[model samples]
Target: KCAQPRRWKAFDGKITEMDTQNSLRGKELLEIYRSINTRGIPKDERTSVLLTLKWTVKEHECKLTQEIVALIDREIDLMSREVKECNLEGLRKRICTLFLQYIKIPEFNPQVAGLIKVPQDPLKLYKNVYFCHSCEKYLAPTEFPIPANSHTIGRCRSCYQLDNEARQREAYFKYRLILENLRKSEVDYQDDSKIVFLVQLPDMQYLIENIWNCQSALSACSDLYDLVMVRWDKQHEWSPWNTILLTKEEADAHLKLCNLQKTYEAPFIYRIEQKHIRAKNYFAQIPVMSSFLHRSSNQSNAN
Candidate 1:
C-alpha cells in the first residue's frame, strides 16, 4: 500500500483512481482516530496513517476533535445508563466523591491508547469502561470515579447526574403545575400571598436535572412564586437519593455542584449559595422551606 509516488505515476501509479479512493477513506478514518486517541487502520499497514496525517493544515485537527468529543459524550451516556438497578446508595456516593477527589483525567483520553491488538471489535475496548454515574453501561472501572473509601471501586458520574436531573425535573414540573393552578384559582391578592415550587429528589441522579430545568419552572410559575425548593424525598420509596428543595444555602450548593451557579459579582467570586448545598450528611433531615424564608438573600444582594 505504501507504493512510491514514482510507481504511482506509471499507472497514475500511486495517484491512480483506486489509490485516490483509498487515500480518502484512510485520511477520514485517521482523523477520527486522532480524536478518540487512536491512529491508523486495523491492519498493520494502515496503523501509521494518522500519525503521518499532516498537522500543518489549518483547522483540520480542530474540526475532527469537536466531532470526536461529541461522539465520546454520546458513548458515555449510553454506557452510564445500563446500571440503573444498582441500589448500593452509600457505595455510589462514596465512589463518586472519591472519584472527584482522585480522578484527574485530562478531560478525554483516546480509548485506543496503548492498544496493540486489532480486536474483532474496537468499540468493545471502549464499552463497559469509564465508570461514570448513571444507569448506563461501562467498559472499565477507571472510567468511573474512584470511591472515597476505596482505591479501586468506581461508579459512573454522568449516570448519577442524569438520574438526579430527571427526578428533579419531574418534581419541578409537578410543583409548577400546582402553582399555576393556584394562581389561576386566586383572585387579586396582596403581595403577602405568594406561591412556591418545592421539589426534592431522593438521590443525586435526579437533582441535577431539576436544577438544570429550573429556568422553565421559574418562568411559568406565578410571579408570586418567588420560592422554589426541590430535593430528594427521604420517603421510603425514594430514600436513598439526593434531595432538592428551597434551601437558601443548600439549593445554591446544588446549583454550584451542577455548575449552574450564576455570576453575581463582576469579579466572578462565588460561594455554595444554597446554604451548604445540602452535603451528604444532611440527606437524612427534613429540609424545610417557607415562602417567607430566603436563604439566598445574600447571593441575590451580591448579584
Candidate 2:
C-alpha cells in the first residue's frame, strides 16, 4: 500500500518531518543529504514529469506480473459491460513476447542456480514459478540471490545468512571446550638426557632433531637419548597432522626405535635395540658414533 514517496507521506506522522530532521546538523550533516528543490515550473510540464516518476516507482525491477494486469482488466470489465471476454491467451502471448525481448537485458548476472529440476510436472508450469522453501513462495528464483556453496544450490540470501550464523555459533562452542581443557592439563619436560623419541615419522624427524639441536643445549656428559614410536597408518590418521608420533624423536632414528619405546611405554627399548638395529634393511644408523664398525650412509645417519 505504501508504494511511492507521496504514499509514504501517510506514515511520516508529520508532513514536515524531513524538514525538521534537516534542521539538526553537525560538521558532516551540513555536507550531505542536502539538495535544492526545482519549484515554480510550468504546471503542464511538472505534471508530465511527476506522472513519469509515478510509473517508474510502480515498476518492479523484474517487470510486472501478468496475473496482476489481468486481474485489473477483469475488474474494469465487471464495472463496464463494454469489455469483451478477458483475453487470457492473448495476454499471455503479449507478455511472453515482452519477457523474451528483455531476456538478456540484465546480461545473465544470476548467482544461484535451481536446486530442483524445474517443471517437474510440465503441465503445472503455469501455476508454479520458482520454489523457495525458505520464504514458502513459488515465485521466480531470480528474485533471490545465490550462495557460494555448492551443497545448498538454490537457497536465497536470507537462508544462506541463517546457515552461516549457525556455523559460527557452533565453532565458538567447539573452540571454547578445547581451550578449557588446555588450561587444565599439566606436562613435564624436565629430563633432557632422556630423548623422548617420536618414531615412524620422517617429517617430524627434522623438527625433533631441531628441538634437540636448537631449542635446548644438553650437557656434554649427558646421554642426550630417548625415543618412542607411534604406529600410524592411512586408516587412522587424525587432524592437526596426518600421522602423530606422540613420542617419536625422528623417523629415521630406526636403530633406537624399540629401545626408546620400551623405556617410555613398558616392555624394553634397551634389550631389543641391538637385535632390531642389526635386523636386515633395518641397518640404518646414526653418524654420531660410527666408530669401530664400517657401513654405508644407508647404514648410518647422514649428518
For every candidate, C-alpha RMSD to the true structure in Å: 25.8, 20.2
> Stretches of candidate 1 above 4 Å error?
1-136, 150-154, 188-303
| Candidate 1, residue 268: how far the Cα is off, in Å | 37
Question: Among all windows of ten consecutive residues in candidate 1, which has the lowest summed lDDT?
Answer: 233-242
**Per-residue CA lDDT of candidate 2, range 172-269, in tens?**
45334332322222112222211112222332334223222312111212122223222222122111122222222343343234454443444433
CA deviation > 4 Å runs, candidate 2: 1-38, 41-128, 143-154, 187-303
lDDT of 1: 0.36
lDDT, each prediction: 0.36, 0.34
What are the models' TM-scores? 0.23, 0.24
The superposed Cα distance between candidate 2 and the true structure at residue 112, in angstroms, equals: 24
